[model samples]
Target: MVRRPTERPGRNDEPDLPPNLFVIGLLHDLKEGGYSRHAWAAFWRASWIRSIQILEMSAELRASWLRFSVTGIVLIALSTVAVTAYFGIGQGIPFALTSVLWWGILMFDLAMHLGLMVNLESGELQQTLGWPNRLTELRGLAAVWVAWGAHWASAGVYVPLVLVFGLAAFTDLLDGWLARRRHASTRWGRLYDPFMDGLFFSVAAISLAVVGILPQWLAALVTLRYAFPIFGGITFLLIRRRTLRVRHTPWGRASSAGIALTVFAAALAAALGLPFQALAPFFYAAVGITALGAFVTILIRGIEQI
Candidate 1:
């Protein structure tokens, strides 16, 4: 008598099962095993849950920082206006200058706190979003912003502010080096780092101009340091349809160092009440050359990529 296929037993199967029964059973087991574990783990993990919590926390933090930054800027502006009002208030020796400088300090503090928040946000985003080395970028930009604010505040003081500014400038370089050495370079950090440097330098130049410390021509050149790059960036974006990349170049590094040194030297001269005019020509020349080199580098690199 012939048994049906399902009724037949083979060595591959259990003694009670047919030949195809084992294959069917294995498939069924695999299907039942499915992705449930993955789903369950994702929902229950600390990292995932903390990401949600951090979103809310970051929102609150960003709000607080924005409020503080705005308020500080407004106070600084008002304090500057109070400079004229000092004469009206009958205060001796322009007490409003002190108020303005104090406002600068407040602004600096706010900027620093904002930077801290950025660092925290970058760190959280890295884990939550799979971004690499973003915290390093954030720290770089933060260092620049902090340095800028310190420089502004120092401008309102004598030599003490310059020392603080110098320290901050040094930290900006140090932070970038640390980031690279520590393997913490990220896209966000790269973009923001140079952007913040441009902003800081622009603001410093403008502040010096406002205080009559920087001659108008030299101030214009300093301002162009930012404007030239920004214009190039915009042009490149418009024409080439590519965002500028931050390449490590010796000339670029030297240009930055030169500009920083020039600013320090100028500040020192101002503090000493010495004639800073001789330094002005050299400073402007350095700025112009650097700006030109940067522009050429960006333009050439951008075009070559296309």
Candidate 2:
């Protein structure tokens, strides 16, 4: 027996999509008499009308998100200011400047996002803040928070800083996994996600050194490992003047994992009052592994260029 052909989606034989809630809510002001007089004509024209209506809704939603995000960042900066003032770091004034600098950086990044947003058509706007991008935003903002937290992090109060760093580190793995599973990877995300990861790790590494949890030499190694790839990619983006799609290299991934583990362990050990001297061997071994992996990644990338 022959089977009936399956109906393709979004064509004849498929049921109409439910109207967007934004459209329904938007039309609440319509008079009952008006609806009764033109309901039939409106049904025939609903598809075209709703498409335009949804486009407007998309833009409205985007505006609302932009407002929320900007306000949230401002609040973070203000809170950092209060914390800095309370902590008296850099006599309270210098750290306030740091907070300002952080806010400026955030604004610049937001500007980059806005530039991309303006170029998007209506459909792209609808999908702008999908699960993966939301994760990316979380990851990026958390990295900034870690950096700010480090500035105010005291040796006496290490636990909070450790918690922030740990959560930010988790977002790295999570965003990558979700992006792959959801097919929501964007070029901007590919660039910024690693940049944020590197930025957070670098900031955490330096903060550890500042707190004497890590020695200067080890901190240097960790910073360089993260910095090399980040600067190289930025340089490429500037020079190429086109879309750049850079995925994580295998060795790079291993390097990040190893470095994060070492940072967390070192911070935790310091917080627990464990002597850095006692765990010097373990910490150094991890650093060596991370450095070796990073070197191999660079060599592999260089070889590909040849």
Candidate 3:
């Protein structure tokens, strides 16, 4: 006798299988004699449903992203107006243009990676953007402002630079605190926050060095503190096609705090006409200890992950 082809479920009088049945039956057969005709049908149907869901989610995500992008632009414009009004039109225009440029680049990059809220622990996607993420984005904009301020530090405007950066750093602490308190920690926030922190402090160090507020050696240490991890992350992503998750460590936090404190002190001292040479020892000790600790910790932890 010849073997007849197996009939696929839901093809004749059989009732359409429920989604769960599709998953369960497909999984069962997959582990047994491979995909039976019913399993193939279930798999195709399940795949179709998932494809529809993804497309719908993508559409909704675009709409939400547009709203978020518009808000960012409005805030950037307002910040430019306020800064220009206070600082005069000459520096104001250039500063505004630069801030807009930064915002555009950041927004474009985020749009390309378009994703909805992702739970920090479960890695599940959600529809809403929580306040923690909103605050993180706010901090990112503040970082752009700091970069502009850093560029102008050479003009002897130490006080303003200090104030701008101080507020930006404060937001860094605030975002994490609020995320924990609200139980709204997210993967995107975790990733974006650290990147912004690195950008914020790196600009502070390099700009100050160029302006002669910080010594070259200290600047290199600060830059390398962030540069190595960032480079490593990019390399890992390129090779593995996935992100390398580096857990926050005490040493990392200490390094960031040390850099911020050093920048604040140097800027304030310059503003007050205090001799920076007297403060050199303090800078070296703070940045040196923290940077070394952070560098070592990151290397060890990163290796463990690899």
Number of the top-ranking candidate, with TM-score as the measure: 3
User: Native-vs-model 3 lDDT?
Assistant: 0.70
Steric collisions counted per model: 1, 0, 0
TM-score, cand. 1 vs. native: 0.52
Top of the candidates by lDDT: 3
Candidate 3 clashing pairs, residues 3+ apart or interchain: none
Query: For candidate 1, what is the lDDT?
Result: 0.51
Off by over 4 Å in 3: 1-64, 240-242
Candidate 3 vs. truth: CA RMSD? 14.2
Model 2: per-residue Cα lDDT at residue 109: 60
Ranking by lDDT: 3, 2, 1
Clashing pairs in 1: 137-189
Give the Cα RMSD of candidate 1.
20.1
Total clashes in model 3, counting residue pairs 3 or more apart in sequence or in different chains: 0
Ranking by TM-score: 3, 2, 1
Q: Tell me the deviation in Å of residue 285 in model 1.
A: 2.6
Candidate number with the higher lDDT (2 or 3): 3
lDDT of each: 0.51, 0.60, 0.70
CA error at residue 72 for candidate 1, angstroms: 12
